[model samples]
Target: MKVIAYGASTSSTSINKALATYAANLIPGADVTVLDINDYPVPMFSEDKEKEIGQAEAAKAFLDAIATADALVISFAEHNGHYPAAYKNLFDWSTRIDQKVFKDIPAVYLATSPGPGGAQSVLAAAKGSAPFFGGNVKATVSVASFYDNFDLEKGQPTNSAVADEIKAAVAKLNA
Candidate 1:
């Protein structure tokens, strides 16, 4: 499968990005493309900006990237219990290009944080609203206390149960 995966943040060293990349690699024999939202930067979306820039090339590029995916794995980064500003901005622009941003692609949504809450608030929001944007959400995983559960050197979850959960979630795309 051709999997398009990304963390929903622009941070240079995003834990969510690392998590997303790790999870995407778990799908056996899958070709994974890990994207950085920074590569598709766009001005913050607004009616006025839309009028000024009609259709953003970056937004179109973002959608085009999704079009190439057989499956998607997105790890959301929560900032103050919500989507990160940079991701939300690019997503808003992409929506303008097509409200169905995911184009019905089967997806696994994940979230991670250093704290115990696991960024579940944003994960819930993403899961709750995915269908509205045509995301075929197959599973969702939230990794809590990221530093404790994840092994940076190994680039995978140190907690065996969490690793299993993520593996199970990604496996659904093939199903």
Candidate 2:
């Protein structure tokens, strides 16, 4: 499978990115592309901006990247329990190019936080909205208290139960 993965954040050291990469690699023999939102920066979306600048190549490229994917691994980073501006801006512009932004791609939706809720609000939002934008969300995973649950050295969850949960989801994604 050709998989496109990304953390919906602009941070260079995004924990969601780390989690996304790890999960993407779990798919057996899949070729994965981990895209950085920083690379696809677009000016904040506004009707005025759209009228002035027209569609950007960056937004089209972002849409094309996922359009060609056999599957997707997306991890949303919660900013005030919502999508960060950068990703949301890209979404807005890209949707103008193609209403089905995800191109009907099957996906494993994930979220994480240093706190106990694990960014669940954002994950829930993505799960609910993804389908409207052509995302076939297959499963969801959330890592709560990320620092305590994930082991960077091992590149997996520290808790066996969490690990098993993630593994099962990854397996389903691969299936």
Candidate 3:
């Protein structure tokens, strides 16, 4: 199976990215592509911007990635209990290019935060909005207290329970 994975954050040291990479690696036979939003940097989405220059190459590339994926694994980074500005910007621009960007693609939505809420609020928002964009929500997980529960240097989940949960989610996707 082909999977496209990404963390919806621009931070170079993002825990969300770590979690996404970890999860993507767990899927058996999954040819995974881990994306960095920085690679697709685009001006904030605005009708004025679109009218002025039309769609950017990065946006087109982003869409093409989604179109080719068999599944999507997104680990959202919550900023102020909502989607990060960078990810939201990408979503807006991609939607403008194609409203049904997800187009019924199976998706494993995830979120991570340093707090106990584990980005639950943003996950809820994504679950609520996913169907509108043609996403087939397959599974979800939230990693709380990311720094405490995961070892950044080791690049693995320090908490056994969290690791097992992530593994189980990956197994389900592979099945």
TM-score, per-candidate, Cα-based: 0.99, 0.96, 0.95
Which stretches of model 2 miss by more than 4 angstroms? none
Query: Per-residue CA lDDT of candidate 1, range 131-166, in tens?
Result: 899989999999999999999888988899999999
User: What does each candidate score in C-alpha RMSD?
Assistant: 0.6, 1.1, 1.1
Q: What's the C-alpha lDDT at position 118 in model 1?
A: 99
Give lDDT for model 1: 0.95
lDDT of 2 by residue, 1-175 (tens): 9999999989887889989999999899999999998898788888999999999789999998998899899989998899998888998999988989988788999999889999999999999988789988888999999989998777777898888877787787756
* Global CA lDDT computed for model 3: 0.89
- CA shift at 57, candidate 2, in angstroms? 1.5
Worst 10 residues of 1 by lDDT: 150-159
Identify the leading candidate in terms of TM-score: 1
Candidate 1 vs candidate 3: the lDDT winner is 1
lDDT of 3 by residue, 89-144 (tens): 98888988888878788888889999999999999999999988888878899999
Worst 10 residues of 3 by lDDT: 166-175
- Candidate lDDT values, in order: 0.95, 0.89, 0.89
* Model 1 spans with C-alpha error above 4 angstroms: none
